[model samples]
Target chain A: MLRRVRYELAGRVAFPLLNALSSWQRQLKRRGRKPRANPFGPPLDCVRKLRELMTAHYYVGRYAQGAVPVAWVTSGFPIEPLRALGFHIVYPENHSALCSAQHAAIDLLQAAEQEGFSGDLCSYARIDLGSALTGITPVGRLPRPDLLACCTNICRTVSYWYKNLASHFDVPVVMVDTPFVYGEAEPHHLSYIEEQLGELIEVAERIAGRRIDPERLERTMRAAWEGLVLWGECLQAGKAVPAPWTAIDGFFHMAPIVTLRGSEQCNSYYRMLRDELSDRVTRGIGGIKEERHRLLWDNLPIWHKLRKLSTLFAERGFNFVVATYTNAWAEAADLIDPAKPLESSAKAYTYVILNRDLEHRLASLKQLAQEYRADGAVLHSNRSCKPYSIGQVDLRSRLAQDLELRVLLLEADHSDPRLYTDEQIDNRIQAFLESFS
Target chain B: MSTATAIGVDVGSTTFKAVICDGTGRILDHLIEPTRPQMEQQAREGIALLVERLGCDPALPISATGYGRKRIPSARQLTEITCHALGAFHLTGRPGLLVDMGGQDTKVVRFGSRGEVLDFAMNDKCAAGTGRFLEVILHRLCVPLTSVAELASKAERPVTVSSTCTVFAESEVVSLVAQGEPVEGIVFGLHRALASRVAALVAPLAVKEPLLMSGGVALNQAMVRALEHALGNRIAVLPRPQLVGALGAALAVRNSQ
Candidate 1:
């Protein structure tokens, strides 16, 4: 039928054209391919042009109307209720990182850094400021934020970040506070967060000037929870011999789950991704051609060293089967109770990122290693990120004693390339691997 | 008469270097190799090879330094800053400033009298100033490592590498090459550009000399020269440049014992 004809067209014509375009682009950038530009024509014009194209698609299309009232909520805020309320959401973390990769984040980041914010402050903050100043974001990217919200459960950075945004836009600001849950959220803590959730609903209703639909919110929460569960299931599928997908690919697809949490589209995407992964699992597909040793990666990657490290691991048959960050998302999903929506939403929001205790982080990593049947663990002692980098040495010792796991502490920065050395890192990895044999 | 020989390993990001030294801080043997998958084994093997080559005893006390030292179980670990200062001070016979540029990271160490570390600044998270970044660009250009200095010597104009990230800088270098800029010119620009980055680390410390440059990157004459030019002064390079970390570790072991 028509579907078959369309598929034929896509396979025969569209795919080839796309492939050719990609190859041509690659060729253009190859060494010795083109003449170098003058020292100062338009610094980062390519980045600007790309951002313009992306922004046009994101903000100017018919989908713009369909764009649900979206807000950028910081971690530690009760975004579940907003998701439940059917509002579109976006995480600035993902967007800032995209901006960083595009090289546009430097000017903006420098502005903040020069303002006496140490270079060690999160790059995301600098990138966000950069995007606001430059107006360059990916094509068809984030919808404009209609509200700015903050919570204190995660880190103090968000309050300042949101305050800056609110001042920029002259928009209303909503702040939520959730008492820290030492281990798990108690009933009182839940009640406190629940009260804030109620206030959020009131504030949101006032801003939108619309009647709040409780049933719709409940439905959204249920769907969002389902989507999160499915996403976790997809990650679990990577536990197979070859690891059906790499962490980089997982990060790419994590968008819909983070931004469109309550929607049918989010649910459908996860279901589809889950099914595709399941198929890969059945077919026994692996990420690496050679399966040597499986290792657990602790903390965030040294962004500057990801490729080198991945290549190093791949060449040696050491696949990073599991990570603590990826697993944290799913754990939050399990805690979301759609029936008692607001309280659960608050609880979920309060617990994310590296806000959890050191022991919790260690336990999660150990669980992933055990579940993935990993041979060893590589802990990147990230220099720029103190919050994520702390307690790794202790965790390494504990894992060695309890799990009897071999551990490697690799010092590097997640984004800053200045902190790592290939000769040093490579030598250490070689030594660690030979010990396993 | 016992030699009292000891082994010191400097496990860097891009290279695994080891040195064997007698009790008087005289280097007997040394080895430098690309860090492989089995780093500790590589260190052990490299040390063993150095010992065998030097006709030294196999059963020497060992100490480790640099980023990967904690993972190497054979020796007590010392920080790169401390070790670099010790090595520089030992080589120069004066305590002043030390600049160590390894594969992936850069550091500027300030030493007080008697080689005590006063304070230090490091550019460890960024790649713009490190030796690994130079290697990546050189590999992309299909140029031998030794030719980089020669290439820089021919540059008519310096091309600025604006990226703080090494990956992005590689693309920038590739684009420069594609633009048909002379390879030598580009190489010169790269060294100058990287020197500027290292200068940023050094400038903050306002370090006084006898300034010493150590680590693998110190072997790059062009970079060393460019760095000297950037700082508007002369810099000293250790005779056994790569052994600086290992030397410091050995010094630490000797002092501790």
Candidate 2:
């Protein structure tokens, strides 16, 4: 009970002031920034709010242990049940990315490697496992998880990665294995996932020592539905000529949906973001000062090189208007229905594009290019993500043949900076953009 | 006829190509030498040789291209892909497929009629399918680079060189020789193996007809023939192919001016 009081004070009183202070400090330092050669337009006003929301989440998370049962979950896990069961959730992928962005991940990655994890394993998994083993993270601290949720809808690596975490923390791991979908998911497949989710709720309830109210789960699903729709709207604003934001912006802005989903906080944040983006669209405000060629990005971003890559294209009047990675979170909204939350969520999480066939991935690319009116596409052949990068060579040809758009298959790892070749990637980017001129 | 106006240099990984070109982008005089560790000095010396031979002013504006492009003192720099596209467009006078097989990398470039790059793919990951691959394997096989064409032509049936890796193929070729396979067949097989890797990069591009070849590897008639067979498209080797990047560097500087 005392732990709950500390957690509440951090979330309600302490974190808000600290977040605002940090945001104010950023604004103060903004004046001292070299102000030269900035290619971006007016920065998003909601960024301050985003910082507050996310920092507060992490700040409050520090006190969550002994107060609330915490479950470390995958990005694609069906988390509504956990939220309804009053579990403090943490997405290790998000934490690893934060660690990457902070430039603190290399040591953790090395720690995992030194512990005998192969270098070729997904960097995200390696970093997370390294953090688990070493208790190192950029975020203040990850509350020790009492439960781990593994969903194979994203990748098989997560199941094993989370298994390592379970062993390290001595916790129960709830598995929701989504069978790989070919063309379309069968009823049996959906039923199978739903049965597993039923088992998940039972395990979670036993751990929480309480029964989950169905109404609360439905409410959480409804909020998630709203948040996903708002995110879709925020992304659709890119349809505007001179998109209101860039895909890099989307990559940063996606934190809420990935972490704070199944909550009113997520919904409220998106509502404010959606309105701001819509206003930008109406006012003809672009993410960059001068938007020329609209391009689409596929696969995860190179987290360490985000600023360099963002400026590399932006200064050249090229903006990434859409990305398949950013679209992943928003695309499953249609599969969600609050009335039958469990079944709909089962269908929703089962049919993610990564879990589907390559044909669906291609079709989605084609549709997104047309909708976003992309003149070029850069498919990041991520070294760590085999599933995303496996069929990109064929997709490059198909996209070029069908759309006559210039496509560049870039080679880089999403999280591990060690694998990136700076000169080679820069040369390709310069040549790719030069072709537009 | 146009006189020498601007000099361009391509400081490639294995070779340095310098050319004095006229206002119309025609080569007046050129120089080619193996690249040394002192790239900028080599570039300067190569330019001096071209200027002295052409009897042009020593102060001609220089534009640089290739891997060591930025290392040279020059008015402008461009990547080999763009330079190859521009030079190929000048030679062919039309946009199509261009395969530039240099010492360290192989590039498949598609360009527009105006000499602007449309698309390009490069294999710089290793020595496979590059001029260096041939150089290494040929030296290992004790075959002169000059006799590659003749040796490959004499083989009625090329032996299968399955390894695309340069180091692995080196050992593989030695084992084949130990097993009494003909050296000529092994050489031809090596060319075929390199051509297949280049072909894989080209296959996804689906470039149209009127394919063109350029760069140092274009001097090897055997490699060109193998690429032609692998691509199943007739290739027109550009005139003074080794000087194509230097020529493009000249044209690009002129365009910028």
In DockQ terms, which candidate is top?
Answer: 2
- Error of model 1, residue B92, in angstroms: 30
Candidate 2: pairs in clash: none
How far off is residue B235 in model 1, in Å?
Answer: 32
TM-score of chain A of 1: 0.80
lDDT by residue (A1-437, candidate 1, tens digit) is 45445434543565456556765786678859665432111122123232333332233321322335556786445666676554545567656655544545566677667765677766677667556655556533455577888787656777787888788767777888766556876788778877877888887777665757878888878987897898899889878877776554555456566555677766776777787777777877766656677788776655545556777677767777777656656778877888878867777876765767787787788888899888788887876557778888678767876887878778776654544577656655654664454
Off by over 4 Å in 1: A1-68, A75-77, A84-86, A140-143, A351-353, A383-385, A416-431, B1-257
Cα lDDT tens digits for candidate 2, A1-437: 99999999999989878877877888798876787777987889999788788888888999999999899999999999999999999998898888888888899999999999999999999999999889888787989998999999988988888888888888999989999999889999999999999999999999888999999999999999988999999999999999999999999999999999989889899999999999999999999999989999999999999999999899989999999999999999998999898899999998898999999999999999999999999999998988889999889988988999899999988888888888778878877887886
Residue A241 lDDT in model 2?
Answer: 90
What global local distance difference test value does model 2 have?
0.90
lDDT, candidate 2, B1-257, per-residue tens: 57788877888989988888888888888888888989988887788887777777898788888878878855577788888898999888898888899998899998888999978898855678799999999999999999999999999889999987889989999999999999999999999999999998888666565888898889999999999899888889999899899999888877776
DockQ of 2: 0.55
> With candidate 2 superimposed using the best TM-score fit, by how many Å does residue B24's alpha carbon deviate from the native?
3.2
